[model samples]
Target: AYEYTLKAEKVCEEGTQKQIPLYDHYFFSILICAEVFKLDSSFHDQAKKIAYKNLKNLKKVQTQMPKNFRSRYLLAKAVIKMNFSPNLKKEISFDFLSVIGVANEDNYLHIEGIACEIYGRFLKDKGIHLDGAHYLKRALGLYERWGANFKVQAIANEISNIQNDDFNKEININSFIEISESLSNERDLEVIFKNILETAITFSNSLKGAIFRRDHNQYFVISNVNNDISHYPQSIIDYAYNSNQIVRIDSIFDLEDFSKDKYFTNNQVRSLLALPLVANGEVESVLYLENSKVDKVFTADKTRILEIISTQMALSIKNAYLFKNLEKLVSERTEELEKKTHQLQISSGEKQTLIRVLCHDLANLLMSSRISFKRLNKKLKELELSDPDITRYLKKIDSSFTNQSHVIDNVRHLELAKEKGFQITLTTVDFLKTLTNSIDTFEQQISTKKINIVINENLNDIEVLSDELCLGVNILNNLISNAIKFTFEGGKISFGLQDDDQEYYYIYIKDSGIGMKDQMVRNMFQDNIHTSTRGTNSEPGSGFGLSIIKSYVNKMNGDISVTSKHKDDFPEESGTTFILKLKKAV
Candidate 1:
């Protein structure tokens, strides 16, 4: 079968076909060859080599295969390793048991049966007759479900042989199963340790028992059953933990120095059994059982059962501690995330409040400065024969004060809109008149930049329902100011208004200047984004114009959008257009 499978593998690999099925055939052939080689001593080395190769290949493709097939491959590899290698018995047993768990989880009945049968046979060969018989019976039941009559009969015959051979000293299979089930279900470390002690006392028929777990260099009694006695003496626990051996005191009176130990004097413990739980070459826990009334209550059979139980308990205790620590870490991280989120919200609120206060105070100071500049300019004009340079200097200072006052007012307007919401008093007004007034306000800046402003003829006499005095003027002023700032010298800026049948007006403001990039256009209207760009003549801007425009447009129940391209990139078609829409008055 191996030779034929190799032939098929070559055909599939060289032919125009899928290689997955060929790989599956190769994997199964290697498994069969390894099993065949295990029967003869001359081929044992070959079997080990084949098994190692199979394990490597299975791992390479395990994730790509189906769950059931992957589990089967793992079980086969573990079984082969167990059979061929005597030194790897402990490691192979863990791998075999892990595969059994996977088989049970994925409901792979055939694989589970195979794993149980192999493990049972292995245990029986190692002189663990009772454990082997228990697993063999379990496998027999599963095989019966699949109508495997030959396998059932074979396992039954093996069970009968074991029973007849050891009828005088029969093992309690039910008690072992019950202890395993109980330990598997328990998740808490303290609870599982207590359960282990309780199960150990019941199995051994001892009066009292206590479990001591080692943490770092310290050993503490974690669980106790039947706690009527006083201290059991830390020296006994330390002796078993440090020695890494079971301390069995069948008869305390037999020892001449028994009175020297404090545990014998303090308690009525006649017989004692302390079993150390060792894992990975380290002592993890110890099980101490005592019988006050009986001298030799713990027998060889009972001690053996306690050893098995202690081994399982050590692993469970370690897993439970790890799970508990993970839960604590997750809880602490969640609390920290919530605290950071709350702090961010508080910081944002404080920043908004500061902007409002600073803008309000700055607006007041600029207003007073403007008043004094106006009075000075009037007195200078009164002296018509005064120096022209003095008059010009005062005019430039006045212009600077006016520009600063406009910027502060815009900031204050934005703060009010954010704080009180965009609440507008809707009144019917001429759209053209409002737009013209907004343009007239920026006349100084427009002349300085030498830009031409054009109002479309169709926008004449248009009426809209808006806060024409304040909100309407502010929205138009922002858009026009931006257009003038960005437009090159002697560039044309056109404005137009159109109304749809749905009673909505569209105001278009197009500029012949440096157009904004795609990213700038995307973030232009966002209040949190600062999209500040220098003008054609290096004129400074506040970056708050678009945010204020968006707020006012939303207040008037309208929307705004822009389309632009950089003037340098496309000299002829390079410009920006601002489209503002509002509700047409009835």
Candidate 2:
């Protein structure tokens, strides 16, 4: 069938112009060929080549293929890889298990069944008869559900052959299955230790047993069952641990002065078996079982089974301890991160409060100085003597004082806005009247600079839903003051407003000024970057105006953006335009 499909695909690609169907046939043919080759040892080399080729093609077209098809292809490739490399069996097994998980999640029952069957066969060939039988039974159940009678029979036959080959091996397989299931299910170290102790007692046919675990080179009993014995003879446990060998005593009377040992004498132990659990050449734990009524109850076969169980138990317990410690470390680190985050918030609030206080104090001092200067100017005029140099110096001092006061006032407003989280009390604000007030505030500067202020006629009656007193006025005042400062003498500053679909009011402020560079414009509204630059007339600036304007605009649920070009780059096009979009008043 696979050869026929490949030939049909080739015919379609060459003659029929049906590319999609041809690709589908090609994918299925490769998949079927790989599976067919996997069943016979003589075809293993062919299977490996086809499987890898399929994997390469799947990678090229997986996104175009169905998810179930992709998962099945991966499973087939993993099976071939396992058969090809003996040294990579463990790695291939993990890959096979992962594919099984994804197949189960996707409810691809056919892929799940095939994966289980292949894994069972692999384990059986490796002499892991117990695990092999477990997987085979699972595959048998899946096949029965799907009504695949042939597959069910094949899997059941394999299981039967494994069981009938060795009777003692069957018992050990059952014990191992039970132990593996218990270890997989239980995570708590105490619970795991108790489960292992119970299984050990049952397998060794002992009346009572206890497991002592090593912690920091100290031995302590971690689990016990059906025994009132609190402590074991330290001498025997030490001998087994230090010698890295099993210590068994069939008859206590065989040793000289054995009655002097309190543990054996008091408990009347007839026979005892102690096995050391070693990992990486280090003794990690010891399993001690005692039979009070029977002599020589623990046989060599039972000891061997116990040895396997003890080795697996040691590794499981170590994993549980490591997991517990990892959880503790994660919790501690999370707590530390939360503490630092809270401290940062408090520090930010404190810094804002300090800025408000400092600005307020500076504003008060400036007001007093302005008043004293007014009186000093009046007295000088009364004296009827005016020196041009003295007059110019006094005017310069007054200008410096005025600029400093304006900067302080703006800073105080900004701090208040931040402290209240930019909260605005909404009110109907006449946009035209707000712009008029801002222009009036900067009238003296505009006149001094000989700047032409242009207002669009359409803005005469515009109104917006905003806080007119704090948010609206502050936003307009900052933008206009910036324009007046940056504009050269006799330059023009224009203001305009337009409504868009009755939803928002757009305001524009453009100025023919010594414009900013692209990098400067990008960082102007960010407080982290210091963007203060002198005006064309060498007038000082605080660099806080644009930041304050952005915050106020956001508070009113508005957006603001700027466009500019450096005068050195394009002298004729060198100017700035600030665009503000605000919600319309209803």
TM-score of 2: 0.34
Cα lDDT of all candidates, in order?
0.68, 0.68
The positional error of residue 483 in candidate 2, measured at the CA in angstroms, is 0.5
Model 2 residue pairs with clashes = none
Q: Candidate 2 local accuracy as lDDT?
A: 0.68
Model 2 lDDT per residue over 217-298, tens place: 6766764543332457666777787888897777766445335667665577767888998754677788888766556656
Q: What is the TM-score of each candidate against the true structure?
A: 0.36, 0.34
Q: Model 1: C-alpha RMSD to truth?
A: 29.4
Per-residue lDDT over 242-347 for candidate 1, one digit per residue giving the tens place of the 0 to 100 score: 8998877777674453456776676776678889876546777788887664566566666765675565455445444544554455446435534554555335
- Model 1: which ten-residue window has the lowest total lDDT? 166-175
| True-structure Cα RMSD, model 2 | 28.6
